[model samples]
Target chain A: MTRDAALLLPSTEPVTLIDPDGHPVPHVGHDLPDPQALVRAYAALISARRFNDQANALVRQGRLAVYPSSHGQEACQIACVQVLDDGDWLFPTYRDSAAIVARGVDPVQALTLLRGDWHSGYDPHATKVAPQATPLATHLLHAVGVAHAARLRGEPTVVMAVCGDGATSEGDFHEALNFAAVFRTPVVFFIQNNEYAISVPLARQTAAPSLAHKGIGYGVPGERVDGNDVAALLKVLGAAVARARAGEGPQLIEAHTYRVQAHTNADDPGRYRSADEVTPWLARDPIMRLETYLRGRGLLDDQDVRGYAEQAEQAAGRMRAGLGEETSADYRDLFTHVYAEPTPQLREQQALVADELSREEER
Target chain B: MSAEKLTMATALNRAMRDAMHADPTVVVFGEDVGPLGGVFRVTDGLTAEFGEQRCFDTPLAESGILGMAIGMAMNGMRPVVEMQFDAFAYPAFEQLVSHAAKMRNRTRGRVEVPLVIRVPYAGGIGGVEHHCDSSEAYYAHTPGLHVIAPSDPADAYGLLRKAIESADPVVFLEPKKLYFSRSEADLTAPVPPIGRAVVRRPGTDATLIAYGPAVPVALEAAEAAAQEGRSLQVVDLRSIVPFDDETVCAAVRSTGRAVVVAEAAGFASVSSEVVARVTERCFHSLHAPIRRVTGFDIPYPPPKLEHVHLPSVDRILDAVDELQWEYA
Candidate 1:
């Protein structure tokens, strides 16, 4: 049966449980999350923000190659990992380092690809996270496939595929959502529309009403939430995940947010837009907004806020020390995993490299 | 043992059926793969036997099909996906190269994409554009992929079975021209190891090397040469990526002359790689400069002109005659 397009459409206005001033905003369908989960999300946001700052410092210190800072989108990042079970999978893009770390991956291991040591520093299977895909929207299809496979095997595993606003312009995005809806795969495509794909604005990226609205065409219901409001994100994402887990098919969630920082340390945002534009987003800072809500409810006191800050500082220090330890790469690593068993040609090439390295040492 | 005469399509169908019976985790899917069977009927009756859960049809999106296959494979399911045609697989090339080929290596062996991408390729049925591209080189050049092509019915069943059981991703290229080619063989025959070349015919003169659709052309050329009192040997290359260097080099060394043939463009192709490798390994034993008979370095022509563009028996013999026969 064909699904009603109107029924699948997102709310014209982005859903908000808490206003930018950190005051609760009651809505018809959504409600505030449990105070415990809100506190956990707050703590993770602090750590994620701290990690982003430290990753920038590492880049300046010559310890890391580069990092795509999720400086302003912490609510969306934490909510993605927080909603999934340990048995579920997370397919993240390179810009999703914040979520990767929030998923309990070691900060240093999570930065492996950005560090230039390997494509992925940590074992993906151990954490049930895919490697941080550098190509835009390419891993979305993989997420759909995993969800479909889980359904086939009678496993109740849900998958979350996270991509940026720019990724919505990619063809794989359409294909992934269409396949997920057709197969009724238990997956959520979480699109963090932070208003830019590098320098291109959301206005130039699409003519659609919203990224979430793009899902309705594929039979996947769409939802939009206030990205700065942690209470709202937790509520919407949690509900979407539950629907998927209950075999209601895939869901698409577009978090309306902003990228306060430049695309990366190398980018100069000053060239693309004026400081006047960032001033508005700073007022709607996800961390500050969430902190105010927690404080107002007495769920988080000054002591708890200070404790989370200290905990984030400790994590940053540990990551800094770990990354500071310089290590040489093993040449054999290049050929070792190209195949489960190295082919003869690869073996011969490995030997050639080894022979050349020894000759250079002799010289 | 009773030998059953089977077409290459039927053999492939049986291989998939047997694989599905043996492993519950193995699945078959692609466009038109279920209910209607594949366009070539390669997956004929699979959905009926295994049910739609095991055998299914996907949307008409090549990248989606391959991308989903990679994900399924990562999750411990051996997925066999079919690209409706050779050219149709181009849209999925990024997924194949970026994810499927590098999934294991990039993840440092933590993930394995055990998938079989079945692409029916090559021109002999006078197929129009997009249907007759011999795209083996694109896959063969990729580091982590295994490129296999079967020349006959037996190898179609045998090699596809091997590809399904493989621990890594395999690009199984089926020669569209040979789909209905008949051969009598035992279905339970133990197949030769992958990446090993098989000597189809023995001779003392120049060796004719080929794979896929070109293999039959080379054999026909060799027979034509034999009638002219020129004993030309024929060697079928079953695998293109982990090239059978030993078997190929040995044949070139014994014959002291060689000719490579393939349906893809000669420049920077699998045929070019074969010539370069044989020349490097058997330079001392060469009685003549190695030659190659390949499709012209242009887009596959219209159905009427394909006969001229594709490597034919005449083209193979011409390449053989150019192997310094006077010096021999």
Candidate 2:
């Protein structure tokens, strides 16, 4: 075994390609993504910011049960989707609504779980994205397994499993990384370190220098990046994805960012944090930072920004219309899909439910 | 039929061998399952026969093994994962309950986790705690999972093969105590599909419903009752979740009395479900209330005191004796 920890350790400082003021920074460790890709990422970030706002509004209107807003972490969400190929899979967490939407899933369908209509709104096989896991860190193992299976089948598929800093504390997280490294599976573990897991802070979550550093013991290389910087995220995550796809092994990436909104609409951030902490992240907003950088480079102009805004509004309008419609769930659906073929007990229960429905209808 | 005296361990090995040979998608992995051939050797020679890709050993993490199995299943491979022992699988309960059991339903049939978790369970192996436990009730209580426990060599081979072929996830409970139990198994015989109870020994006075490790004890009790001039039927329930109520109730209705037996604890157990179902369907034809012969509702005891805790032949006979034979 190679005793060298240099290859496995993350950079001393998180890699950043663009500063908070939107100026390009010199980073010898990593290179920036292409200008076109950065512009596309900027477009996604704008749409995602609007998507988070629209979802939060829907929650208030009682159209959605709850929404975990990825308001400031749009760069990580968009980069997670943009860095992957069509054949690759993405295992997203419950808070990754933005990533799911970025992957081309219908916006309304992406909110189905929040709308309380279904467990998962879209088909996983069709989207190549596993259903957003509510339970923490469990899906990471699934991502590793999918990557391992792809390798076994001689398929060129790299799986990107994304979770929050809070999930890094879970045992499944350790198991997933260890399994991936041991098997040399094509998986890139992306951690959107949004500082807190609900009320818990990063300090309380782990004593490790960084979440990425935890991967060194497992022999999986780690990389830390500025999650708010799209250029940096694209470059770092893209390199990790390419490395994994090239049969180098799994990689762990911890993206340092902040969750500007509460953990969910139900949560009160005031109970744990102050406005002073929230005010700083507002100025460091991912969309504005990327817009500034792209504008300086002349890749994006005023007309282009207006066009992106109109597109975002149209997308949000479509989501509003789709979510406003009534959802009629068939009572019989409860008994279906539990198995390939319903068991005798399920059939009996189905009959009971049908009888109850008929009796209610008669009354 | 070839007269080959086979053990349950060997039968299970042959089942995996056959299934792997038939389907290239089938892969088997678990701790100590590769070159070690597993502690019980149920996976003996699998590695030699199918290479590391098909038959392998995984890290000693139950959740990881099970979670990976679900992923492999989703990606078009049939993973037959082992939990090493019954109690050891507790760590993966979340994976089993949340994902393996709910994936298909959660995805609205868009995805199916066609994986089998083989857990060697029940006491009588003189093993320490965590090595021996009848954990079938935990899996049986979960929906969208087929909980199967075979009592003999033939059933073990057949059920495991059927489990691998199932489109839905299956929790296969292998009784460690009976791993070496020998029988003249006809491997070529077409085994019955899941969700069917077999009348191991048909009788009339009372129905003895048992499964897994409890079957032999119930059968011996039936034999003992025969010497005492009492007819006791033995019913081995192969599958728990998709329970064979038709077969079990039919036997109970014929006997007019039922005695449910299992090595697991009595309260809210598989045996309790059996008693309730039999009582529900055979209530009118019953002469006496159904009785349950099960392990105590306490933590499993040490090996020295396990006999007193586990359901035995005497306990089944006692339950049968308590079935109000006065009416007959």
lDDT tens readout by residue for model 1, A8-103: 999999999988888999899987888899899999999999999999899999899888889889888999999989899999998899899999
Which regions in candidate 1 have their CA more than 4 angstroms from the true location? none
> Per-residue lDDT of B198-236 in model 2, one digit per residue for the tens?
999989899899999999999999999999999999999
The top-ranked prediction according to DockQ is 2
lDDT of 2 by residue, A329-351 (tens): 77677789998999998899999
Worst 10 residues of 2 chain A by lDDT: A1-10
- Candidates' chain B TM-scores in the order shown: 0.99, 0.99
Chain A TM-score values, per prediction: 0.98, 0.98
Candidate 1 local distance difference test against the native: 0.92
lDDT for B125 (candidate 1)? 88
* DockQ of candidate 2, scored on C-alphas against the true complex (2 decimals): 0.90
Which residue pairs show backbone clashes in model 2?
none
How do all models score by TM-score?
A: 0.99, 0.99
